[model samples]
Target: MGDGATTTEAGPESAGVGAGLTRAHWWILLAAALGWMFDAMDQRLFILARSPAIRDLAAGADPSALPALAGWATALFIAGWATGGLVFGLIGDRYGRVRTMALTILMYSVFTGLSGLARSWPEFAAYRFLCGMGIGGEYAAGVALVAEAMPARFRPIALGMVQAASSIGAMLGSALSLLVGPQSRVGGWEGWRILFFFGVIPSVLLVLLRFRVPEPDRWLRARDEARRDPKPGRELGDVRAIFADPVLRRRSLIGMTLGMVGQIGLWSIGLYTPELVRDVVFREHRRELAVEADSLDDLARAWATETGGDADSKLSEWKAEADRHVGRGTLLQDVGSLLGAPFCTWIAIRFGRRKAFATAYAMSMASVWLVFGGMSRGVDALWMLPLLGFCTCGIFGVIVVYLPELYPTRLRTTGMGFCYNMARYLTAAAPVLLGRLAAGAGGYSRAAIIMSFIYVLGLAVVPFAHETRGEPLPD
Candidate 1:
């Protein structure tokens, strides 16, 4: 078997001294960051596009069916994402990070582009599920590729930089939706279709990637020549190896727990903020409508007794006024996401990953409390909703850097994929549980408090983890 130790001229010293960055390291960082940026953009675009598309598709249909469909689509997408991470993570370990990264990018980009062609909700959901498969694979491949390529001394920074790039993509998705959404000629469902079509631009990146990136020398050297020579197509047993060792087993378990907690908070609570905002807006609109209806009814009674004008016209005017308020609320939620993402990115880098993650979750819990509690009290605490988003989003950047350092190169992708993606299972179900709780309690405040307690659990876990700040990647 070929020992996994391919030597490269570019070693730890090439990462640059304390004062500056090296050119090669810069190139590696840029490549990974750019790839991750697009990956984030593609994943988020689906979420951003969902509301308008659902509204159009559910037009004249039972209102309850739309949220149900959205929930189903989200579950399917996460499943596909988990599958991609597991399958490609093994492939990355056996083959090469560079090759796997290129393949993953192409796979995701192509499917995301194909999503633009979907005509039915089922079709759109299927495309998104497929796109998610590729998108999920991208993280392990991209993180491993950059980590392996860069000097050990700079691994965290490189990975952190890549993680931060997700914010750029997310922000871009928000901007794209805002700009093209209203201006789209397709109207309703068609506008969403146009947005998906624009997703094709990332595929062009595949061609550039083919020429620019090279497979990491580390994986090439790690390849067991004896194994490869006799059976070139044979796959290595990374999963078996991960559990075969005692320390690795512990690390794997810890990593998975961390991932599950992180993802549940992120996917279930964090991603649904927009929906929550919409609900709040809807409730407010209903209140406004009721107030207007009562006023109009009183006016109509006076008019009937005096001038004898029509009641139906006054009712219609009140309905239009309520609709305007709902529309404005939706717009605010969308616009707020863009503003929130950058701040989140900045916080992750500035405050450190552990602190940043804890803070974000803390804020999210508080925000949910304010939303559910403050609403009944007639407090306009809507701003806390987006601030929670800003805090939660910062954790993505932290995870990118933190997860890679948790494993050695031999099992980096495998460990990361298992830890990061498998957690989606927990997250996938979190919203439903939260929804049920919200229904039972007649509000989301209790659920928010529950989520806050989970964050406290995370705080306890963080201290047990080894601090990797400025530390070299473990050998």
Candidate 2:
């Protein structure tokens, strides 16, 4: 192994007790978490609101075209997200992390709110894509801020906590859609407009960020060192510095692979659970509906009378039930986060980072297989849905904790941006794939089984990564 020396000189005060994180650390964590929470909330709201808005805009047009529009919008958003990660990751590395964080939050927030004003699908898609660029930048900046601020011993826990906070944001988004979505009167495209407006709430945090967060001391030191040295600034050499060594290269690769699989599985399995349930419900409803049909109106009237509810009421009731299902899934996901995050932190502290990752991956694989595979049939299978969420959430919660540990401070944001955002692009294809599989197989259970199998691939790669538990943050 290369002798890992501090890349920059530390102040005399920096040497003692590593100056165990003070109130400032907690304040930084709070600011980062809030920003991330809103970041996630806005992204998820777009997903939730998009379909309805597209359907409304396409009214008097072919219904089949809506899915295509959604796909196009999603593609545009992902492209923006990837671009943001690449551009802002460099910016964070070159500029101050605090400044970059502020810029990123403002960029995403303004566009996210602007998405509210979109009158057509093209306008909405454009706004969302712009908003995505901002959203994508937040992860790198926020992760860097929290990673740099916390004491090394507490970094894993801090990152885990921040990662878990996103779940809370996602759950809140779901709750808002359930609560405020139905009450909105903007029949065509207005429902989504209101939801987009709700995304503006996080922009308010920008004002507070100016007062609360500071530039990371590590970053400041690096800049000072760069200024003092004869080396030219804006050197392309720093880019190669990340991969010049074997250990760093290995860690970066491992981080990238883990991120790719984890992201694909998270979106494919986690976010799509509701769609899976809906497919099942629809199939069951269709079978029941097929039993009798006179005229379509007669069939509708008779079915409504027999069901003892109007279509809207029945839909509302189904929606309430779906909310309960999603609620359970969300709760389980949170519980997993609560358990796995601390556990991974503690394990990484005592055992090692690699072992901790392996253990988590093992549990994640088993949990996913059991929940998705085991639930392939029978009434008891329904219970597995929430259980799956619990297990996978724990797996995901381990990411923020572990990834930062793998890279030195200088390359941390770049490594993280590459791992996280690249995976997002790769995983973006999953929803379409899962939809195709569900369509071909005539059910979602098969699609879930396929998804669970991919987790095993992730498990196999765990052993290849270098162990970092109890190791000080690499220089």
> Which candidate tops TM-score?
2
Q: Compared with the true structure, what per-residue lDDT tens digits does model 1 show for residues 294-364? A: 23335445444554666666544543343333233333433444344444444544555566556655665
Q: For model 2, name the residue pairs that clash.
A: 353-469
How far residue 414's Cα lies from its native spot in candidate 1, in Å, is: 0.9
Q: What TM-score does structure 2 among the candidates reach? A: 0.82
Cα lDDT tens digits for candidate 2, 174-291: 6676665522445554656777888878877777777766777776666666667736422321546566777767777777788777666666665555445434444444466774
Every model's TM-score: 0.78, 0.82
Residue 322 displacement (Å), model 1: 11
